[model samples]
Target: MTYAFGDTDLAARRLALLAETFAPSSRTFMVEAAHTGLRLAADLGCGPGYSTHLLAGALEPAHTVGLDNSESFLDLARATASDKVSFCCHDITTGPFPSGPYDLLFSRFELTHLQHPEAVIELWGRQLAVGGRLLMEEVEYIGTTHPVFTSYLEIQQAMLTEQGNSLYIGPVLDAVPDPAALKRRSSNVQTAPIPAERAAAMFRMNLGVWRHNDFVRRTLDPSDLDDLESALAAIESGRSAVSSVEWGLRRVVMDRVDP
Candidate 1:
């Protein structure tokens, strides 16, 4: 399994953005979906555990498990472990789920990386207890008028396609076993403005992540990547002035039906 953007500094920076700009809305959506009586919850692809921690606070699951395939990320999650929250190392696609019949199973931006997301969803659905809910959040599209970000996204999309993954996996949610069980709770295009310095750092980190990848080199124009790198450095060094760096993100939330 090739995770083009694995657990790295770039992933961490992106996680920060998700934590600050995305998770609140997602938590609110899930909370409204199941107002009370949420007992156990699992966060698939929990990464460094931001969403897992958030789920713990929002649902107060009696036992919350943050599952991921990366031991490095699991180590980071375990460091912040609490009585109610724990970390598990397991890939959601093929590995055995830790223990389920859970009150909630949640994942974000994870489906896009998998070749068989529907299969994973079916397996996770079986783990839900009666009346339990499955919630997922994924990017429908990333829109940006910023040239640098747009160019970066283009390359990113190509890289994902090369890896047999889709950066836009929103429509695949419909392929779940019971189409009626998936509810499209929210869909919108919004832009989160990041400080120029922080945005520059994020771009640099991602470029670093992709720079060494053979697929990236073979699939994208080398000169363009170099130009983007230089452009980001200029943006960071005050050679260029950007009023605000924006990320146009679209997200959809799906809820599993009660059985």
Candidate 2:
């Protein structure tokens, strides 16, 4: 599966901002859903190690391994590796994971990029030790009144649709029955209100990553994209303050039910 967002330096920077924006929600999910005494944890699709570090800090697992396909991101992740925290370059979607049957598996904003998320979840569940938990955080809804924000989302959703993915994949996952060896423990939406400027900054950075995408160039007018980018930049720079964007994140926790 191709990542709509490239893994360039700019993309890494955007992910950094994204990690900062969503850390609170992810931390709360870990605190509420994960049990103590976890021997090992894996942060799937870890980018630049931010989420990996977050997991280590929150659960304090005896060992934590972050897995991703991008070597550049892994390089950054390894730079800050600790005795208890390490990273592996592996495609998380296809795994006989290099590591073990983890006590916990965490992924944030990852399922949206996948084609067969349910199958992937099942694969991940099988890699977990019996009774281990899998925590997933994904987009349920993004509520925004600003025109620029709405426009950006429309284009993004369209592009993802073309790729056989969904930008709003939370409700879709909610409908998926528990995958083999995994039983649904909890699923709920947590609303996070992002400041207009912060939201604009994120949107602008994301637009920069995918504006050159073939689908984007084919489907959107160059002038319109230019306008949207400028508008987002204006908001991000504080020259314009639009209404805040509210994200309803679906937080799902599942427990391994079979060996």
Candidate 3:
């Protein structure tokens, strides 16, 4: 499952597939994001609009912006985008983010991709409005119940690295980004429960969710395809599925205190 810079299209396709797998959990994730009252939210590295769609309808804000560098994704995003929302395609790290002081700077699985997710966090924090919150959903590979899923994931990950891709931080959450600076305002984290029947799909779904730079397809290999099929079958039968095995998700919410 080695990835190459040339395979962006394939990577996008694979992530789109994975997004379909985790589509089941979108509602729960969205509900929590909305309840947080993220009025001026920014979906950084928004892939195929998974959480963006959820956020747009969930928040009653005047505007929500979906940001990403992928032309493929922005096209789909624009088509699926609500009239209340907007889209932008640009390299987030290099390009300036749309003017902010945003009520919410939210991103799922986007931070970990950065060589320094923490640094990115610091930058995003600067964009927060007074009383704004940053809700980040990140995945770390702890382990898996299904042998095929775990092995397949490791292989895929190794392949991605070989292709010069840097992954989001490993699932060891505490190391991700410390909230010591953020705690003053108020911060908390929780893990989303994954049902066993959905395990295989869940793990693969997490890996596949990035959809960043058409990541999955570039990393895909014959073996990876086999793993995906097997996991999908297991999930369909409500049996041991190839999900995020041992790794747990770390959701960190940092809010700016209104002084």
Predicted structure with the largest lDDT when compared to the true one: 2
Error of 1 at 243 (Å): 6.6
Which runs in model 1 stand beyond 4 Å of their true positions?
Answer: 174-200, 221-223, 236-259
- Against the true structure, candidate 3 reaches a TM-score of 0.69
Put down candidate 1 lDDT per residue, 1-259, tens digits, no spaces. Answer: 9567777766766676657656657677568655455778899899889999988888787889999988877888899899999999888886457887677888877888888777677677667765567777776666456688678778878888888888878666644455444444555544556667567666666787877788888766778789998887887777777766655444444455654
Clashes of 1: 0
How would the candidate models be sorted by lDDT, starting from the highest? 2, 1, 3
Global lDDT of model 1: 0.73
Better of 2 and 3 by lDDT: 2
Tens digits of lDDT, candidate 3, 1-259: 2223222554556556545544445445556644544457788877667667666766656778888877877877788777678888756665347767687766766654554566666667667766677777666544555565556566556655655444434343345555433433323344445554555544444444433335455766656565666665677477643344333555666776543
Q: Give the range where candidate 3 is weakest over 10 consecutive residues by summed lDDT.
A: 1-10
Question: For each candidate, how many residue pairs have backbone atoms clashing (under 3 Å)?
Answer: 0, 0, 19
TM-score of each: 0.83, 0.98, 0.69
lDDT of 2 at 43: 96
Q: How much lDDT does candidate 3 score?
A: 0.59
Candidate 2 achieves a global lDDT of 0.92
* Residue runs of model 2 more than 4 Å from their true location after superposition: none
